[model samples]
Target: MKVNELFKEELKVINMGLRSFADDVKSQDVPVLHVDWRPVAGGNKKLSSLLSKLKSK
Candidate 1:
């Protein structure tokens, strides 16, 4: 597909980790898929690394 084709299509957004952003985008009447995402271990780097290692195995 060409870059111009993307501009012709309707705008859609996948807002992750921030509901406020999704709400802001929705105010413009655009399609949005809001994902209430967060870090695996509350943004704890060491624990997240350990969990990632476990998941890989």
Candidate 2:
């Protein structure tokens, strides 16, 4: 094959890859909300015991 043909094929592959990546980025560009909890000072023994019991079961 000629070098020009090979180069064109590589460019096509790269263009396709870039388009796919751009589509993915655009799809995930929305803001997201997350929830989390923090333990109180010294922690709650009742909550800790419940968690341990749930894990064992």
Query: Which candidate number has the best TM-score?
Result: 1
**Candidate 2 Cα errors over 4 Å, as ranges:** 1-42
lDDT computed for candidate 1? 0.92
What would the TM-score be for candidate 2 when compared with the true structure? 0.27
Put down candidate 2 lDDT per residue, 1-37, tens digits, no spaces. Answer: 6887866653321122235554554467533223233
Cα RMSD (angstroms) for every candidate in the order listed: 2.6, 15.5
* Model 1 TM-score, all chains together: 0.63
lDDT for each candidate structure: 0.92, 0.51
Quality of model 2 by C-alpha lDDT: 0.51
